[model samples]
Target: MTDVRVVNEQAEQLVGAAETLFAAGVMARSGHANLSARLDGERFLLTPGFVRGLRPGQLATVSLDGRVLEGELSSVSAEIISMHSAIYRARPQVGAVIHTHSPAATAFALAHRPLPCRTEPMLRFGQAEDVPVVPWGPRGSDVSVRGISDVLERRPTTAAVLLANHGLLVFGPDSAATAHLVVAIEESAEAEIAAAAIGGAVDFPEGAVEAVRASIARVSA
Candidate 1:
C-alpha cells in the first residue's frame, strides 16, 4: 500500500494543476477535466470529479488493472478508468495523464483534424509531427481505449493527441510537462485556426525540430 501522505501529495499536485489550467482558460465550458499521476507501477491517483475547485479528498486511487483501490470515484470519472489506464500500460515512462476540453483544441478534435506542428512551442516540446486524432469511440469503451493506445504506440514521440469529437489527451514524464504540453497544444491550435483567416499557418523549415532539440540539449548542458 502506498503511504496516505504520499497519496495526498499526488492529489495536491492535481489540485494545483487544476487551478493552473483553469486560470489559463483550458477547462471545458462546464469546467470538467480529469488528471492522474502514478502512485507506483501498480496504481495511480485520479481526479474523482470536476477539475475546477477540486479538493484532495475528491480523488480516487485506482489500480492499473482497473480496480478502485481507495476513495470514491465519481460515475463520470469511473468511465474514464480504462482510457487513462491504457496510456500507463503502453507508455510505462509516463508519470501523469490529463484530459481536457480546451475550446480551440476541441475544435480540432470536433473536426477530426490533427493540430499541425507549425508553432515554435510545438517544436520546442518535441511535437514535430502534427498532433494525431484518435478515432471516436464510446467513452471508456474498449474501442476508445484501443484507439488511444494504438495512436500512442504509433506516435512514440507525441506527448498529446486529440480525441475525436471529444477533447484532448496528454501524458508526459511528469505532471508539469503534461500540463504545459496541453497548454502549448491548445495555443498552437488556436493560432492555427486564426491563421487560416490569412494564408493558413506555415510549417517550419526542414530541421527546425532538430534545431530546437539541439537548443534544448545546450541549455541542459
Candidate 2:
C-alpha cells in the first residue's frame, strides 16, 4: 500500500484538477469524470465517482493491475479501472489520466473526426498531429480498453484522444499537465468550430509543430 500521506497528496491534486476543469467550463454537465494519478510503480490514486465537488477523502487507491488497495471504489469508478490501467501499462511515463465529456472535444468525438492542431496551444502542448478518435465500444469493456491501448501504442507523441461518441481522455506526467491539455484541446476545438462560420480553421504548416519544439528547446537550453 502506498503511504497515507502520499495518497492524500495525490488525491488533493485530483480534486484541484477537477475544479480547474469545471472552472474552465469544459467539464460535462453531469459533472461526472474520472481522474487518477500514479502513486508509484504499482499503485495510483483515483477519484471514486463524480468529479464535481470532489475532495481528498473521496479518492481510492488502486493498483496498476486494477485492485482497489485503499479507500472505496464506486461501481462507476470500478468500471473504468481497466480503461485507466491500459494507459499506464502502455506508457510508463504517464503519471495521470483524466476522462471527461468536455463539450467541444466531445463534439469531435461524436463526429468521429480527429481534433486537428489549428491553434498554437495545440502545438505548444505536444499535440503535433490531429487528436485521434477511438471507435466507440462499451465503456470499460475489453474492446474499449483495447482500442484505447492500440491508439496509445500507435500515437506515442499525442497527449490526448477522442473516445468516439463518448468523451475526451488526456494523460500526462501529472494531473496539472493533463488538466491543462484537456482545456487546451477543448478551447482549440471551440475556436475552430466558430471559425467555420466565416472560413474554416487553418492548420499549421508542415514544419510548424517541429519548429515550435525546436524553439522551446533552444529557449530552455
lDDT per residue for candidate 2 within 173-197, as digits (tens), equals 9998899888999999999889989
List the lowest-lDDT window of 10 residues for candidate 2.
120-129
lDDT of candidate 1 at residue 172, scale 0 to 100 = 84
Q: Each candidate's lDDT (Cα)?
A: 0.87, 0.88
Clashing pairs in 1: none
Q: State the lDDT of candidate 1 residue by residue for 37-131, as single tens digits.
A: 99888899898658778888888889988889888987778999898999999989998999999999999999999999898887776567899
TM-scores for candidates 1 onward, in order: 0.95, 0.94
**Residue 123 CA error for candidate 1 (Å)?**
2.2
